[model samples]
Target: MRNFKAFGHVIIALFIISLSAWCHGQVELDKAPMEKAEKDALFSTIQGFVGNWWNGSDLYPDPCGWTPIEGVSCDLFDGFWYVTVLNIGPIYENSLSCAKNLEFRPHLFELKHLKTLSLFKCFRSQRRHQVTIPNANWENLAGSLRSLEFRSNTGLIGKIPSSFGVLKKLQSLVLLENGLTGEIPPEIGNLKKLNRLVIAENYLSGHIPDIFTALGDLLILDLSRNSLSGSLPLTLGCLTSLLKLDVSNNHLEGNLLKEFAYLKNLTLLDLGNNRFSGGLTLSIQEMHSLEEMVLSNNAIGGDIRILKWENLHNLVSLDLSNMGLNGEIPESIIQLKRLRFLRLSDNNLTGNLSPKLSTLPSLNALYVSGNNLAGELKFSMEFYGKMGTRFGAWNNPNLCCPLGAIATSNVPFGVKPCQQQIKLVESNTNGSDVNKTFYSIASLCHAPNHFWWTFPFIMILFLNSYIIGL
Candidate 1:
């Protein structure tokens, strides 16, 4: 009986030990391989922000596991789950907290596996507290980072770090609509692998660096609305792969470079509101892929006919408003079948408005106001009504003609009533008397409705007398 009891106790002990070992193994499998030190650093940095949802608790004990944090993604690296992308913003509800004085924590650089880091309107503050981007340790992650973006942070002030050139793997870098000042670092040319670099709507000044021609793979380069000045470098033409290039609303001066024709892939080129002078060059006609060309509010001069506009078949929008352009508008412009917006306002252009201009199937907005244009508006009533205020042909003194079918109020402003001309014969009359009689005939024709029938009756009477005399 003693031996039986002892054997039963031994069996129970062995079973309990086996069960304990199996449970331990399962627990190990459930836990993440991420180092506890790195996890604590990430959570601590997030805690400093007042509006963040990350609170150190068992509720999210494994950040890389089932309870993953918002705007944070992880991937397995060397048998450990590491944060690979950190998109800190209000991307998801109850995700990130917004706080003033939100300085980037050094602990963020500890995520050695981070490939992309974006902060959208995250550093904004009601108090206008300025935050400078940290330039000290960016080189630490140069090897891992592939993209970095900081958009619409009004309080972000400071020059872009030249150290960013060391990030060889970076493909896209966008720092749009910030308060950043100073010249774009020439070192940015070193980013050979970069595809898109947009730093528009900032206080950046100085001439565009000639070194930019080195970025052969760049597709979109927008440095608009800055204080940049100087002539564009001829080297810009080397960027054959460029699709969109906007350098508008700056102080840039000089003649448009002919080398721009080399950008075969360019779709949009905006150099408006600058000091560019000289005539529209043939270089622009060579851009077969161009869709929108904006040279408005510049000093560009020359007749519209100087351009071989027929070559630009893909053009959709052409804005040459307020340029010192003169001479008659080229009738060939009607060849642009895809044209939708044509703005030639505030120019010195002359000649009668083309009837075909109003008939273009795709044209919706036509602004030729403030020009020296004359003659009658022969557009269809339906087309004129459809254009409405978009047809701005005001401020032209000699432009005449009443709207047909469409109300006069619907017609473009400053249009005068069409004049009537009547030829009079004064046999044996001197020059002065003939002039007086001509003026009298003109005044008679100016009279209300009676003038139309009265003039015809007078003409028939003169014809009958001449026939009888003959």
Candidate 2:
């Protein structure tokens, strides 16, 4: 009876030990597959980047643990290697693609860990008597890409594909200096993580997208140098994070939107070379951080009252050129203590040249040319004596004396004598100076000749009288 009980106990103990061992083995087995899966996924992503269609050259068949291409970086998380960045710009631009039909690699979409991808200066190889197309597959880009830049691709064309919205993780998208055309896709607003959106220097047309207001996190929005028409969208003020906004060089027109006052964080704003009209009278009090402001080449017309510069204490560069501004350049401009560059050219401004501009210690470059500005242009001690070659104001038709006459103005400053003749052409062509000079010379010559002829006759008459007296 004792032996049988002992045997049963031994059998039970062996069975329990076997079960524990099996459970441990199973856990070990499960971890190996999980780790393998992660490694495979990462390797696959790296292979995709290497085999990208844009990289027509077989330069990098395997970038992982090899002589990785320049601008390309990899990161190893866990036991897997993944491409964190693929700056294929240098490779694509350096290698010439002679392929008749260039194609963008769809394999790049497999890079699940891609964080940044920039394609700059990717030019196609020159072909003689053959028409070659560009290799840009915007749709095949990895959705995991956080930052994508395709700037200065001189040969790039075609409309922006709507599939761009699939990049949910995208934070920045720059497509500047391309030949892209067609209307902007409203689906661009789908990038909730987007902070900077640049599509400048393209042939894009149509109205400004109202959906852009959904990009609440946007900081820099540049759609300049496009054919976009219509008024500025008032909804653009919703981007509170906006630091720089450039919609210049477009066909956009209208007055400065009242909603622009809400852009308190804006530092650089450019509305130049547009058809924007109407008076600019929004309270700029909240724009304390504003540094550079350009409203040049617009049709904005008014009496040209300048607000207090004390509020714009941080202003560095201010350009109000070609706005049909008439009236004196306000004395308040000198109060902008931090002003470095000021341009008020091509306006109908009439004012006495300000000596106060020379007193500003921070004044570097000032351009008030092509205006009806009159009065003596005085060269400040700081301008001629200290900061030489930094002052420039030309083509002010009414500004006479020193500036108009280059010979007298530059000579006093110890400027080198010009080897060429200095001719001052008066702006008023109807002046009678030429006629006055002709009449004066003719009158002076007539009097001298008449006196000489009459003097001979008088001498002869006196001789005859003396003979009669004799």
Candidate 3:
């Protein structure tokens, strides 16, 4: 009886083990195959790029040792798996100057599910030489890509591939600080999904594209420091969503367009160092959100009165230097309670310095040099001394000597006498002899050799005056 019971117990244990194995198989089968393949590709790409030393650096969790890589993520919806985002910038290594030799493991393109590709510092190609990014490798990339970032690729040279515009789903494109040369492709305007586009610090040349005006969704646009030339398109006003617009350091020219008032949401507008000319219009005051404006080094001419800065309460830095401005330093600037740096130098401004400038609680740096400003440099100098600030107003020829004390270390005392330390008795005797000679000369002019007559005439005149008084 004991042997039969022991055999039954063994049978039950075997049955339990068999059920557990079947359940594990079901769990494995439940995972989507396509998703798994995509994850594997992502994992391989990271490992190949990061090298063996970074096999498992606690970046992310992966059950199959292939799902998680740093800066890489995948999403699955409705049983369909796709790479929703890939921010593999911080992990890419670029040692070779040639971008082609930068070792971008082509396997990354196999991630057919990729939607966002951000690989900053990936361009390793040297100047003038075209580094061929394998366009074929991206052949299988899913059509869902929405955003792409390739920033800080200083060595990157070559035009953006026309194929880039084919990314219909692309929303935000950032390719800043590259050595890219040539004109910005007009096809870029085809990217209707684009909102924030930045291509600053490149050697790009040519006119601003009117298609950019069609980008109503564009919120932030920076095209500074390029060799781009031509007039700014009036269509720029169409960007109603623009929050920041920076076109500084280009060769662009033309008068300030009134259409600029359309960018109502603009917070920071920098048109500095361009060839833009003409007078600043009252329309500039329409920018309600303008916080920092840098129109320095342009040929902008005008009165500060035309600009309504009441809306610019948040202004922090205002630079209008070398713009041929002529006027008094506006006391209205004192209303900018948040101003930190104010530069309005190299202009024709003339007026007594604003005392309000010294009293501004937040004002730190104020430069108003190379102007017709004159007055007692006393007010300005005393203000500087009180604030412990550096003052510079060196070259106003009309400015007088006391004010010229700014150029001196110390003020000198009274001038020294030509004859030093004559004996008192000798000086008195010399003075008396000089007085006698003076009287002799007076007598000769009145009447030659008539000293006695001169004395009598003097006495007679004194007596006549006394008689009249009596």
Candidate 4:
């Protein structure tokens, strides 16, 4: 009986040990496996762009587990770890920095699951080491990428890659502040899912592709600071959901299109510093959702009364400076209670300003300089003080400050006080003696201590003396 009890105890101890070992094996099996192909591709990509000195195996062995690369993230797909994000720039502290001779490796596109790839301020302008974006293989990332950005890379020169259109899943495509040249390719019209397309501050030229109509879901489309020309496409109206559209500082021309009114949701419409000519379009009155409208530095000539200024009730900033505008500033503009910055300078405007402008709840900067405005500014002392130099009513030869305004009001810059007209008497005598008498009489009248009561008496006496001598 004692031997049987001992045997049972031994059997129980063995069973407990076996169960513990099995649980340990299960834990090991649950860990996600890193594929050898993915690891090799990732290492080669980093080596190609960040320089060959980086050895991922020696520095970060388990890239998805115990050790991780900065600016790199991963996801598990079908029990294997895959890289889903790779950022090459100094955006974060201790982030991977691009080498001076950065080159795109084939392995980069091999990152099958990459959803976001950003390179910011990495390629400083070095002509000898200039590199263009990969001309092919972008289709590999088209299946999974959601965002791609290349910002401020001056050395990354060349025309924009047309293969970028293959990124069917891309939502945001930003290539701002690069040295890219050549016309924007029309192939980008294929990105029907793209919402934010910003290609500003590049040397891109040619007409804004009318193909933009296909991007119905686009929200922000900024092509500003490019050398693009041609009329703004009427097709832009198709982007019904667009909120901001900036194409300023281009060589575009033509009359303001009626189609612009169709952008009912657009909050900002900046077409400034272009060559667009013609008077204000009748359709502009319907852009009630516009919060800021900058049409300055164009040749848009018309009076303020052409359109009912009261229609833009949501306007906060309105810049129409240097656009050859003439005529009176209508009182209807004061209906814009939200207006903060109003610029109507450097034009041929002729009129008296409305004191109601000061009453605007948010009026901060008011510029009416370089016009033909006349009459005294009647803004409140507080208004003048608060605005100070922000009120730029200068270069108007006929405009003047209110009486006694200089003492209290922060008089609008470059304005003069209204002066009383002084009439001078003409002498009839024609000899040198007559000239001498006139000079003496004028000097007496101008004397600082002269009495106003004696001025006429002195002038008459001098005239009579001159006649007697003649």
Among these predicted structures, which one has the highest TM-score? 4
Two-way lDDT contest, 2 vs 4, winner: 4
lDDT of 4 by residue, 381-436 (tens): 88888997888988999888754564453667677766544344445556442223
Count of clashing residue pairs in every prediction = 2, 0, 2, 0
lDDT of 2 by residue, 1-470 (tens): 99999999999999999999999976553333223343344444334333334432343334444445467666765644567786745455443222333334445555666788776655332332222123344444445688988777656676787767777778999988876788888889888889999999989999988876678999999999999999988788788889999999999998887777788899998999999888665555467788999989999977666556577778899999899888888888788888998888788888777877887778777777787777665665436545444554556655543422242223122121212233322222454332111111111111333544565686577567545544
lDDT value, candidate 1, whole model: 0.81
Error of 3 at 130 (Å): 5.3
Error of model 3, residue 196, in angstroms = 0.9
> What are the lDDT scores of the predictions, listed in order?
0.81, 0.68, 0.68, 0.85
Query: The CA-based lDDT of model 3 is what?
Result: 0.68
Q: What is the lDDT of candidate 2?
A: 0.68
Identify the runs in model 4 with alpha carbons over 4 angstroms from their true place: 1-31, 57-61, 421-470
TM-score of each: 0.81, 0.69, 0.70, 0.83
List candidate 3 stretches off by more than 4 Å. 1-67, 78-81, 89-100, 103-110, 125-130, 133-142, 378-392, 397-470
**Which 10-residue window of candidate 1 scores lowest in summed lDDT?**
436-445
Worst 10 residues of 4 by lDDT: 437-446
Report the Cα RMSD per candidate.
Answer: 9.4, 15.4, 14.5, 9.3
**What lDDT tens digits, residue by residue, belong to model 1 across residues 263-365?**
9999999999999998888899899899999999999888878888888888899999999999998988899999999999999999989989976789999
Clashes of 1: 2
> Which ten-residue region of model 2 has the weakest summed lDDT?
437-446
Clashing pairs in 4: none
